[model samples]
Target: MVKVSFSSALAQKEVKKDAESLLPGEKDPEVGVPLRQPSRAWCWCMCLGLALMLSGVVVGGAYLYRYYIVEEGRVFVCGVKYREEDYIIREEEEVQLPSHFQLRKLEESIRILEREQVALINVPVPEFQDSDPADIVHDFHRRLTAYLDLSLNKCYVIPLNTSVVMLPTDLVQLLDNIRMGTYLPQSYLIHEEMVVTEQLQHVEQLGYFIHSLCQGKDTYRLQRRDRILGMQKREALNCHKIRHFESNVVVETLICEP
Candidate 1:
C-alpha cells in the first residue's frame, strides 16, 4: 500500500507541472508581443522615410522646370555710328563768290533710284533749332532749291524747322490737333503721290525721303504723331526713330494707329 501511495503522489505532481507550463506565467517582459507582428515604432519610421523620398522627387521636378523653361526671345536695341562715305551716292556743287572766291557744297544723296532699294516709311523727324533762325532758314531754302534742281525723282523730301518746335504741354490738347492725328496717313499719301507722279521710282526711295524730312522743321510733326499714337496704345513711344547704322539709314518703327 505504501508503494502505491508514493506512485500516485508522483503522478499528481507531474500533472500539476504540465498545467503550469501550458498556461504560461505573466508574459515575458522582453518578448511581450509576437516577433512576426510589425511594431508601431517601425511603421512610423517607414512612413517618415517614404515621405522624405516623395518630397525630394517633387523638389527636383520644380527645379528642372524653372531651369529649362521661360527665358528666351527678347528684343534689344543698340546704337551704332556710321560715316558719310557709306552712302550709295554722293554729289557736290560749286558756288561762285565775290573776289574770285568759290565754295564747294557737299551733296550727299542715297541711291534710292537703284533696283536694290531700302524702304523708309513714317520715320519720326526730330525738331530743328537755329542760333540765328533767319540765316538758317535762308540757307535751308537755298540748299533745298539746289536739291530740287537735281531732279533725282526717286525720293520725296519734307523739311523740318528745328528752332521753333516744342513738345506739347498738355497731351489731351495735342491730340485734338488735326495735323498730328493724320500725319502718318498724310505722309503715306504724300509718298504715294510722289510715286504716282514719277517723282519716286522705287519703294526704297522712301528712306531718302524720311531722312530729308528728319533734317529740319517737319520732325516735330512726326514726334507729335508718335506720342499721340503711343498714348492711345498705352505704351511709351518715346523712341521715335529706327536707324540702320551701317547704312546711314533711319526709319519709323513701333507706332501703331489706334
Candidate 2:
C-alpha cells in the first residue's frame, strides 16, 4: 500500500468544495441517506384490500356451514316420514301375533329333557354373521321343543304353535289310537322354515325363554312354503335346514343369513 499525508490547507479546500456542491435538502452520501417513506394513501389502500379479503372468507365459510346443516335436516326428515309410512302399511297387511311374553310362557311349560347321545337340535340363531363359529345344538328327545346353542353354550326353548303343533299328551295319545286302529290316520308331511330378518330389539321384554332363542341374534320369521314343492327344491343361499321326527310330526327349521 501507498501512504501519503495531506497538508492542512489542502484538506480544508476539499471539505469546502464538497459543501458548496450539495443541494439544499439532500443529505450528504458519506453520512448515509434515509429511504423515501411510503404515502399514507398507499398504506390505507393495502389495509382495505386485506380487510375485504378476510371478510369474503368469513362470509363464504358461513354460507357453506348453513348449506350443509339444511341438507342434513332435510335428509333426516325424509327418512322419518318414509319409516312412518312403512309402519302404517305393515300394520294393515300383517296380523299381529301375541307379544313375545305370551309365547315365552308357552315354551316354558315344556320340559327341557336330558341330552341324547347324538345331538339333533342344531339350529342357528338370528343375525348369523360370516365370522360366527359353527354353532350346533341337539333336540334330543325328538320333541323339537328346545335346543342348545354351542356358540353361547346356552339352551333355548322354542315356543310351539298350539294352532299347529299338538300338545305332547295329545301327540302320545294319537299314536296309541293309531296303533289300536281307532281310525285310519292319514299321514302327510309339512315343511316349516325359519329365516333371519331384522334385528330383535328389546330382548329383555321377551322373558328368559324367548331371550335365549333371540339373544345375540336378529329376529327370525317362519316362511311357509308348499310342502311338496319346497321339499323338492333347493334351499336358498346361506340357508340350513334341520329335519326331525317328533313322534307324529316331521319338523324342519331352516336358518339362513340375513
Candidate 3:
C-alpha cells in the first residue's frame, strides 16, 4: 500500500503538467479532436436503446405469464376437492394415482353386480317385521367385512342395499320371561331356506347372527352355548368358503331341545 501511494504521488507531477498544457492560452500541444460533451444524437440514441430493451423485457414477461400461468389446470373434475380430473404432473405437487388395472376390475365387478337386480330374498316373510333399521344394516355390513377379511388381501366397502331376513327371538324371549320358564330355541335362518344368489351366502350367515343375538339367552337352549362361546364369540362369522356353493353352515339353535 505504501509503495502504491509513493508511485501515485510521483505520477501526480506529470498529470499536473498535462493539465497545464491543455489550458485555453496553452500552445505547442499535439493537435487532436477537442474534448467536448456527448452529441445530442448520441444521447437520443442511448435513450431509445434503453426504451426498446425495457419494452422487449415487458413483452417477454407477458408471453411467459400467459403460456405458463393462464394455461394451467384447464381440465374439469369432481370429487371431495375441486381438482382437475386430469392432473398435470408438477415438480412441486405429489399425487398417488390409483392402479388402472385394479380400478377397472373393481368397476367391472360393480357394474356386473348392479346389472343383477337386488339379491333375491332368502325366505318369504308373510309380513314385514319391525326391527332397529340401523342395527340390521350395520350388522350386515360388518358381517360382510369379516367374511371378506380372510379371502381379500385389500379392503373396500362393497356397495349394496342389504336387507337380511331373520327369525324373531325377541318375542320368544318376552314370552319366556312372562312364563318364568326357559323356552327351547330354533335353528337360525340359513342360506338354503332363502332365494339368495351364489354371491350372497355370507349375508345369509349375517341373518343367522341377528336372529341368535335377538334370542338373548332367555331359553335353556341358548344358555349353555353362549356360556360356552364366552369371549371367543364375534358378531361376524368368518368363513373361508362363504361364497362356495358346496359348503353349508347351519348355525346352532340357541335354545335347547324341548
Best by TM-score: 2
Instruction: Tell me the tens digit of each residue's lDDT in model 2 across 1-258.
Output: 999888999999999988877858765679876789999999999999999999999999887864453223100000000110112223235545434422110001122222221122222332323212223222323323333334544333443444445444544444445544432222223455544434435655644334445576644333333332434346554655443333343344544443
Q: Tell me each candidate's RMSD, in Å, in order.
A: 22.1, 22.6, 27.7
Best by lDDT: 2
For 92-205, candidate 1 gives per-residue lDDT tens digits of 634322444322111121111112112112211222211101101111212221012111222223333223211222211232342333221111000000111113223233
Q: Which stretches of candidate 1 lie over 4 Å from their true place?
A: 1-34, 72-258
lDDT: worst 10-residue window of model 1: 186-195
Q: Is candidate 1 or candidate 2 better by lDDT?
A: 2
lDDT of 3 by residue, 5-121 (tens): 357876999899989978988666576657898899999999999999999999999988755553332121111111113234455566565544121000001000111111111
> What lDDT would each prediction earn against the true structure?
0.28, 0.40, 0.28
Cα lDDT, model 1, residue 254? 22
Candidate 2 TM-score over all chains jointly: 0.30
What residue runs in model 2 are displaced by over 4 Å at the alpha carbon? 1-160, 172-189, 212-236
Candidate 3 versus the native: TM-score? 0.19
Q: Worst 10-residue stretch by lDDT in candidate 3?
A: 104-113
- 65: Cα error in model 3, Å: 0.4
